[model samples]
Target: MVVAGRIHRRHFIIGAAGTAGAVVAIGANGVDAPALAQQTTEPQNGKALPEVVSWKDPDAVIVHTELTVETKRDKIGTSGITPSTELYLRNNLPSPSEEAVANRDSWEVSFEGVQNERTMTVGDLKRLGIETVAAVLQCSGNGRALFDHEASGTQWSTGAAGNLIWSGVPVRTVVEALGGVAAGRAFMTSTGGESLPEGIDPQTVIVERSIPADIAMERAILAWEMNGQPVPLAHGGPLRVVIPGFYGINNVKYVKKVAFTETESDAAIQRTGYRVRPVGVSGAPDQPSMWEMKVKSWVTHPLVDQQSGRIQIFGVAFGGNSAVQRVEVSTDGGQSWREANFVGPDLGSYAWRPFVLPVDLSPGTYTITSRATDASGNVQEEVTEPNHRGYDYSGWRRLAVDVTVT
Candidate 1:
């Protein structure tokens, strides 16, 4: 009960040791806070974390489990940025200046607006077949830290988002090899960005758009490779656009052309300004705009700890079609709740699953909470509905820590 600078709610407890009457009946009863943490550490790979356990009774808690970092290279000058793949290669863009990345030898992939015109290459797209998906490419502002009111271009704090395996060729096999599309229409594509960083202008990089063409030809693709290789160039090299569930600004990068048309090309980045605020609507900041995606989660461990039940609680959860189903947890910050055990095999949709909760705390001063549910029923809403370009998703994410039972 000491809220001055924050971090103080009386703490510590995970039980069954000296059993002072079961730690006062489980501290008068209360425990449960999970659904995130543990995998993302690399003090140069020495690996030696775990020392954060606070308890004075905000509900005594501890969580430490996160370590996942790999390196690829080339995203910018100095190669600066690193926090588990730097927000999935700084959100993607670059490629398509009359395409010619030092000669992939001879590449081609044009397919103009519907019912005619076609073109292909890369060995005729590896013989016009070969598909191999595994999707997950988020960046609809990922979380933009609940927008915080304004000032952004990409300060991205929660590590953007990732998950791959993508192979390529689809957009309903290049809009049925460019000879189909009559009613209603939409599917313009036209990727390629990055070239504006120096002196800006080249028409500010160029990124086209258009959708609905039979749902963007059944979830676009064209991806030339990833998690396998040859797709580097800070990600999205040779060819891009996975669009599985949408986001990552419709997944168009370096792509080149796919058009199909029916008119709806406001040009990528969701029609010019990266858009937001249009879910339920709020003040009147000039309405009308769309491009959904608003569920997010990230807490990667204690970030700093001491002792208690040792500790363990991880992170990673995303949404579009959802599929987390359940993952509740609260260590006395949200009052009470339990259920944090989802290691893998849910594979529902929009990937990004990794969770852990194996604590034995009892030292005091805790605050952690994680909740999720998806599969269309959508249930991650604790409170977050007030847009104006804010773009924050279903809410409720409070994490604090400290412990030392001795």
Candidate 2:
């Protein structure tokens, strides 16, 4: 279906989700998203926010303090899908002017990685094909706060991730329509539309990333719509690249360029930034680029004191690049584990599922944490290794918090 105007939220949820347990599907299928506020008083560096991300729920999302803003963990509710208004914001450069995206049909994105090296407008791309995918968009530095060393970037906790529906033209459809990918190409590099300021090194601050070609061809999309609405400006509007099973950085916002290259782009974001290295070592191309995500899960409910009997433990879990097999809850801090049943519909392999384990408790302080297992048999790491950038801190123990049941 070509995106003519206002795509309904219901179509995507019912069509995209595969039923899991008896629990009803939340997110798009559950209920209408909360309305966005016209005003905000959230502070950033003692002053008011630079700009009002009017589309975002001011009360639900946090601003400043962490690179951009992040969502409150509790606001990242049990709903399998995150509403656009409630999604977190993380950006390297500022969003383009409203004029740039005012006429969505006029927006042009050049395709230079294949035989049909031509530029196509957003309207042109929309006519190609329509597909929907549910995947988790998580910051590569999501668990940075959990790391022992002070990570340089955002101090994101669990709120940095969200499972949402993306409706767009399949990258494969575009590639095939444009005569397929060029030979000798190993990476698919996508560029954001955010304008760069004069004088600064473009390479240092620009947002461009190149991912493995095979993965891009198989799972990437040029998303013009997000969470059932035209992609909002705050969350990358007009169009953005959606690469499932990859970190949030890989999903370039305000995307206007797609290229096939034999080698990874020398773009700083792809070259030195977002690289994982030792605590003392500087990021280099040789070090791993924070691309594929690791299997992980963390408790969202019971963050505070709870009642003694019949309490349900709730959290979100996902298999980074595979299906989540199971999630184990450890009340004794990882000493022992019990399987938890999934409460929402299985949103495919890449998206996270809400899980629950109802347990009766007596008055006492109990530490709680959850571990996830992916279809590949990869279990969530017990502790994160020390790194200079403090990326991918999957240690379940750090997520452990005490809650007194009375």
Candidate 3:
């Protein structure tokens, strides 16, 4: 069988892993509850969801967009790094004018909460330093559609996530050069430069987020390049913020301003939008923010018909911030599992790992799934914890696919 035009070195499993059984409805009080009813949703509103002509991949799934796009699972081959042309698009606002991106070096970004506040051109930042890091760029609402309840917002599936390489100047490097962060800062807030439309309250929809200062200091960077190319206009060119380990919301696209604040930004997106509250509760500042990601893995290949014997199973596994320690795949719906082998070079802990498992099957029906464990020892959850917005769905249940072998 031609598997994405590539083959991997086989690493046999020493033994099988025991199953964790099927997911049953249980509440916080530890009482068995009835299952949440399945929900059906309507297409997103606004202008018709049109194809992104600029994107080279014809097979891309155009979910709901103000330019929102997703990579079809099968297209996410065994490669550890996702290509720039293949990356999913998740724009909150329209791209800046052609004039703004016409020249790459002249784009300006301002820095605040330092001993001195100042603005600099992208060309100027290129002179300070350069660093390259590979990371997962997943939408905060990536697995929304898999939730049993109607959690509102774009209904996304596994396609809404990808791992890519970023090149940029470290946030700490630039901050130190500007005489270091000013005292009393607890949060590092970043803002996008996209122009806001009229009639809407600017505070309600602006793409601004404030993450803990330590997170920003440790892994944040002012990225000018993605997947080795200059940042594109459609994908937050000529500059974006890369906050490794945090959800995509905190890595503001088209980042124009970076400031250190004593409190989180009061923007509605930060205070109310991405907050994770109980299914029926309203979002608030007191609720958990969709900041870091959880451990996730999903089957990607062999999603179609198979002919049984020696078939190879493929999927992706990653910890939101930590390195994945192992991935186990089961053909019997988690009743039994075999550890999978990692394919390709390790792209570092921030990126996802492509995994493969080989098994022989007779003609019949089967349900296949995969579960991941991170370096922190956090195992992928068997079910998503329902939230008001349906943020990150990392469970392997909905990720599984039914297959038939002739």
Highest lDDT against the true fold, candidate: 2
lDDT, candidate 2, 1-406, per-residue tens? 1122211110111111221221132233333233534455453324344463654555566665433777666565676888766677788888898887689878899998798999999899989989999999998887677666676777777678888899999888999999999999999999888899999998888899999999999999999888777877767888999999999999999888999999998989999988988898987999999999999998876666655677778888999899999999988777899999997789899999888888888988787889999999999977777788878877777777666665
Tell me the tens digit of each residue's lDDT in model 3 across 1-406.
Answer: 1122121111111111211111111111211111211212122222333332243343334545557777666667786877654567788778887677789889898999989899999999999998999999899999887776787778787778889789999999999899999999999999998899899999988999999998898999999888767776777888999998888878887788999999999999999888988878987999889889999998876666566577778888999889998999999777898999999989998899999998999998778889999999999987777777888888776678776666
Task: Tell me the whole-model lDDT of each prediction, alpha carbons only.
Answer: 0.49, 0.79, 0.78
Clashes of 1: 51
Q: Counting only residues 3 or more apart in sequence or on different chains, how many pairs clash (N, Cα, C under 3 Å) in candidate 2?
A: 0
Which whole-number lDDT from 0 to 100 does residue 44 have in model 3? Answer: 29
**Each prediction's Cα RMSD?**
19.3, 9.7, 11.8
Per-residue C-alpha lDDT of model 1 across residues 136-234, encoded as one tens digit per residue: 565554444443345344534343555566777776775665566655655555555445456754443456655566656666677776654455434
Lowest-scoring 10 consecutive residues by lDDT in candidate 1? 72-81
Q: Return the TM-score for each candidate structure.
A: 0.30, 0.89, 0.87
Runs of candidate 2 with Cα error greater than 4 angstroms are: 1-34, 39-52, 65-67
- Ranked by TM-score, the better of candidates 2 and 3 is 2
Candidates sorted by TM-score, best first: 2, 3, 1
